[model samples]
Target: MARTYHVYIMSNRHRTVLYIGVTGNLAHRVHAHQDGTGSAFTRRYNVTDLIYAEPYADVDEALRREKQLKRWTRAKKLGLIRRQNPTLQTIQGPYG
Candidate 1:
């Protein structure tokens, strides 16, 4: 089976911090963040709320999108995410 890559956005409960990441296993990666094991940044900021995600066939495409999203202003990022999730609530269930 072909592998899929994903670019995902997550935030703290207060919505004060945003995290962008690329992963082949989105569920496992997000679970790690939720458990404070994803990265120094996510752990330090307590950013574990999964808000937005997009899949790509190629890892490079997912990585490039992650980089692009990281460079965006907070307002821009929120805008993009709001298109799918207006309330910015934690998306439940399987996102992969």
Candidate 2:
């Protein structure tokens, strides 16, 4: 079976901080974040909301996208998220 990769963004409830990450299993990765085991930054900032995600066929592509997004200005990142999720709602659960 072909592998799938995901580039995702997580934000705090107040939307003050954004966390970008790449993973082969988005659902599990998000679950870790939600469970407070993902990263120190996410845990400290309380950034568990999965606001955005994009799928890629290759891990390299997903990593590249993650790096690109990480380098973006906060405004640009917010714009990107807003474009896909205008309401900036928390996207969790299966396949999140």
**Each model's C-alpha lDDT?**
0.93, 0.93
Measured with C-alpha atoms, the lDDT of residue 52 in candidate 2 is 96
lDDT of 2 by residue, 6-64 (tens): 99999999999999999999998998998999999999999889999999999999999
Taking all chains together, the TM-score of candidate 2 against the true structure is 0.95
Q: What is the C-alpha RMSD of each candidate to the true structure, in Å?
A: 0.8, 1.0
Off by over 4 Å in 1: none
Clashes of each: 0, 0
Please give the lDDT score for candidate 1.
0.93
Worst 10 residues of 2 by lDDT: 87-96
Tens-place lDDT per residue, model 1, 1-96, is 999999999999999999999999999999999999999999999999999999999999888999999999999999999999999999985877
Pairs in steric clash, model 1:
none
RMSD of 1: 0.8
